[model samples]
Target: MEQRELGFTKIRLPVVGQGTWQMEEADEAACIDAIRRGIDAGMTHIDTAEMYGAGEVESLVGKAIEGRRDEVFLVSKVLPSNASYAGTLAACERSLERLRTDRLDLYLLHWPGSEPLEETLRAFKDLRAQGKIRHFGVSNFDQAELSRAIALAGPSEIACNQVFYHLLERAIEHRVLPLCERHGIAVVAYSPFGSGRFPAPDSMGGKVLASIAAAHGATPRQVALRFLLRRQPVFVIPKAARAAHALDNAAAGDLRLTSEDLARIDTAFPLGPDRGVLPTL
Candidate 1:
């Protein structure tokens, strides 16, 4: 599997990471089992959030990584409502407690909020200075908001900006990708399989994925995930609690899509199509 440096961070994140948002209320043993399988399958990054099930997700992830935290790039975020300076700081401390870690690999502001952007960025910078977090990032922030934060935050690195980027929802290509390209920021793609919508041919991912998956005897999920990995050095987080499902997503790293296949996918799901606007990336 190919790895990419998370912005300037020394950590080389894998192309596939495990997402913990939907695993909030999941059974403890089951969640641990899934995470264990994910890591064993060579997924080194994990994403979670404070707002998910009122911090239960982080707590479960913390428990899952009891002795293996050092091997994973653990990522957690504060919710959008906690965008104020003090609020964001307080939320980070809470996340640390719930995650049972003194420092985080990556900490993100969940979304663009009504509060001033500096207020949110200040909390991130101060946390980094205190060594509470190794990397800072944001989720669901549009391109303009990202630019404003970058300007206000001075020269500090913005490690990752996670958003929905799938065949059905490719709006970020116009708004987010160019800005990210300019600033050397890494894009983390969530819902790469289009959020459990029509799997392949019926969905915007199109028949190219199906044909490729058939050739390799893999599933549509792997094909879709690899598609995102092929575009712009992004890490894809597709949720799966079952071992078989996780393995399927992980297998995408093994197969490389051809140029013709990529072209077919792009044609089937154009980036800036007005008629088929994807939700957000």
Candidate 2:
């Protein structure tokens, strides 16, 4: 798979990653196999959070990467509720233990919360210094919040910003994305398939995607993922619990959409004025 730098960092990550959200212990075997399949297919960037399955997903991730840690770029997030300086310190330790790794390639603040951003950033700096985390970033932050975060930590301190971004949810395009581009913060787009809310294959939007997919001999999911991949510095982590689905998403990294195809997709799903409401999850 093609790789891109994470923000201004020297670390390069695959354009597509694997997301572990709502994965439970009940399906641990399947989830592990799917993750390994993604890795085998060159989707080496794996994202998870302590909030996912109450950390069970991290445990599963830990097991999956048991002896192949050197081959993956692991990322995890701290819950906003644990954004306190001391809480953040403790949270990192817990996450590191669950992930069975000494340091995270990238650590993120799950979202904005009641805690002061300064305190969280201070903890991030300390963790980096202590080698508990290599980089730090944020998730679900809009323009104003991201501006404040950058002001608090300086532009280069934040390595990325994970947000809800897709063809249908293009609110970030208006301001958030431009701001990140200015600061050189990589945009990690989660729920690229709308968390199962994507239009069916027979729907209007789906029909457009299908036509494009058919031309490329790809699935609608691959077409959607490739659309996101074409946006440089923007990485998409779509959840796939099945190995087949994981491989399907991985194949998107190789599917190149032509300029005319992009134009058609743009006409079908026009990017409009940013919605004032902040996107979540």
Candidate 3:
């Protein structure tokens, strides 16, 4: 895998990262092995959240990255309910405790809750100011919300946005993508494979991804991941607790899709309807 600089943050991140949404749901040894596989393959960015398995995933990730901390760009998020300044400060301490780290490379607002945008961005700015986090961002935000967050963050701060984006889910392109492009916000794409919605090598959605995969001798998931990586300024974190699956996601960074393949995939999978939904931070 290769590294890419995060927009404005100046953080060198991997193109394809590992997401630990359910790492602990799998056996411990297997989980650690999968993480090791990802690092061995150069997938250095790992994303997690405080609510994920009630902090079990962060603990496991902490253990996995224990000796290889410098090799990984560790990212975790504070829940929406904890979006306030005081709550965010406490959340950061707890996350650091659970993650067994003193500081986080990136700290994100888990979901967009009902809180005012300014309130949340203030918490992020505070976190950045105190050196609790190297970068701050929002997840599952719509175009308008992301624009607001960017404006609130100002051009001085690196405010990346995380959201669901895949070959089957192109809704981000309609508004969020352009807004991020206008500003310098890099996108952190989660669920790049649609959570296995395009699993079959023979289905329209799956075949479309696989056709692009064959062109690069990659899997459908890899093709789907690469599609997102090549889409503007985006990085993808596809989760897998199995070593083989983790390595496959890492291999996506090694594959390069041609413009023709990119166009084919883009047209075949146009942006879907925007529900104007923002996950509750």
Candidate 4:
């Protein structure tokens, strides 16, 4: 699988990772198998959140990574409701317990909350100092909030900004992406499939994806994943609750769409109005 640097650090993450957003909705054993299959296929960056199933997903990830934990780059987020300085500390401990791990490769504030940003950042720093988490980032932050967080945490201290990004929603292209790129913060694209609202087969965008996929001997799903990887400092974590889907998504890492393919896709799925609101789950 292709790898990209995380922020300005030497750490490089797989361009394709497994997202455990709604894994709890699937069969438990199937979800575990899917995660393991994804790891074997080099989709080793697993992203989960405490908000997911109220922490049940983390426990499932813990089981999946069992003895092979060292092979994966683990990431988790703290819900905004639990992002206070002290709440952040407690939440990390709980996530660690649920994940059956001592430290997280990367930790993030799920989104801005009522707590002061500085307190949350302080907790992140303390966790880093205590070897509980290697790096910290934010999620679902808009331009103003992101800019403010960066100002408080300093550019280098913030590792990445995980946000919603897919073909139909390109609002971040207006401001967020440029800011992250300039500050050397990696951008993690969540819900890469747009919550399963794929274009109908008869739709123009659907036909375009099909044509491009046929050219590359790929599926429309793979084409969608590849389109998001066309630029640098951008990566995706699409949910894969079954082993077959996990392997299929992992294969997208090897796809190299041609310039013409990209141009055609851009036309088919043109960026809509920049509403200035970064989509969040």
Output the lDDT of residue 256, model 4: 94
Per-candidate local distance difference test: 0.80, 0.90, 0.81, 0.92
Off by over 4 Å in 4: none
Model 3 — which ten-residue stretch has the worst lDDT? 272-281
What shift in Å separates residue 95 of candidate 4 from its native position after superposition? 0.1
| lDDT tens digits, residue span 201-247, model 4 | 78999999998999889999999999988878799999998999999
Identify the runs in model 2 with alpha carbons over 4 angstroms from their true place: none
lDDT of 2 by residue, 1-281 (tens): 88888888968888999998887844789889999999999999999999998888899999999999999999999999999999999999999999999999999999999998899999999999999899999999999999999999986999999999887878888888888889899999999998877868787888999999999999988888888766677999998888998999999988889999888788777887767766775
Give a tens-digit lDDT track for model 3, residues 167-208.
767777778887787777888888777775665766676778
RMSD of 2: 1.1
Q: Give the CA lDDT, 0 to 100, for residue 193 in model 3.
A: 73
Q: Write the per-residue lDDT of candidate 1 for residues 13-49, one digit (tens) a residue.
A: 7889988777865667877888888888888789999
Backbone clashes in model 2, listed as residue pairs: none
**Superposed Cα deviation of residue 6, candidate 1 (Å):** 1.3
Query: How are the candidates ranked when ordered by TM-score, highest leading?
Result: 4, 2, 1, 3
TM-scores for the candidates: 0.93, 0.97, 0.92, 0.98
Backbone atom clashes (below 3 Å) for every candidate? 1, 0, 4, 0
